[model samples]
Target: MQHKHGISPRMEHYSCMVTLLGRAGKLDDAYDIINQMPFEPDGCIWGSLLGSCRVHGNVVLAEPENASNYVLLSNIYAYKKMWDGVNRLRDMMKTVGLKKEKGCSWIEIKNKVHMLLAGDSSNPMMAAITEKQ
Candidate 1:
């Protein structure tokens, strides 16, 4: 449809297509789309693919460079009681210096947004917020 309208599909479009295909259990099709895209797949595209891989229990497509992919695959292996796989992934992460990033979140109060990291208490208003709760 895009080609018919003389419009070129962009990265986001390709990523969305890949995500849809993956969700539908069409991983091979999604992978083919990624390979055939004119532009190199960016982090978002790879991330989507990795997420789908997790959903489909297909870690063979995961690459080591993407820390998140390794983490997800490791978690899947752990869930399936595959200790060796989990340990191997952890060792790989250590060798590559890819520590999983801390998870953070944001909330809005009184029209202001506050960023919060896990186990964080450094924010000036943290005490106040905790007291209020």
Candidate 2:
């Protein structure tokens, strides 16, 4: 597209390619694309690769300051029943004095935003939402 169509590769295009390649287990290629990007990889780009890593059970690291990445990686290991990985990750965190941050998410509904936190079932619609799922 860049050479033939004279179109420049944008972040979104790179993100899509990374998602596709990573999901297909072409992790190396996906990473290569990220490294070749004209700009620094953003959260979405890294998130795509991390998600693929989770699916394929491949251990990978993301932003060092983002505790969520470590938690997600640890959870992936737990899902795969890899006790050693989970233990090692926890031990590493302890050694580094890194604490897991509580997960929080927000959704917009009718132009109003609602926030929910992990392990907190205080949302008014929690019961209905849980039932629907």
Q: Provide C-alpha RMSD values for all models, in order.
A: 4.4, 4.6
Candidate 1, residue 46: the lDDT equals 84
Name the runs in model 1 displaced over 4 angstroms: 103-133
Clashing pairs in 1: none
Position 83, candidate 1: lDDT: 94
Candidate with top TM-score is: 1
Residue 108, model 1: lDDT of 73
Q: Rate residue 46 of model 2 by lDDT.
A: 85
Q: Candidate 2 residues 4-94, lDDT tens each?
A: 9999989999999999998899988999999999999887788788888888877754333345566768878898898898898888888
Lowest summed lDDT window (length 10), candidate 2: 60-69
Per-prediction TM-score to the true structure, in the order listed? 0.73, 0.64
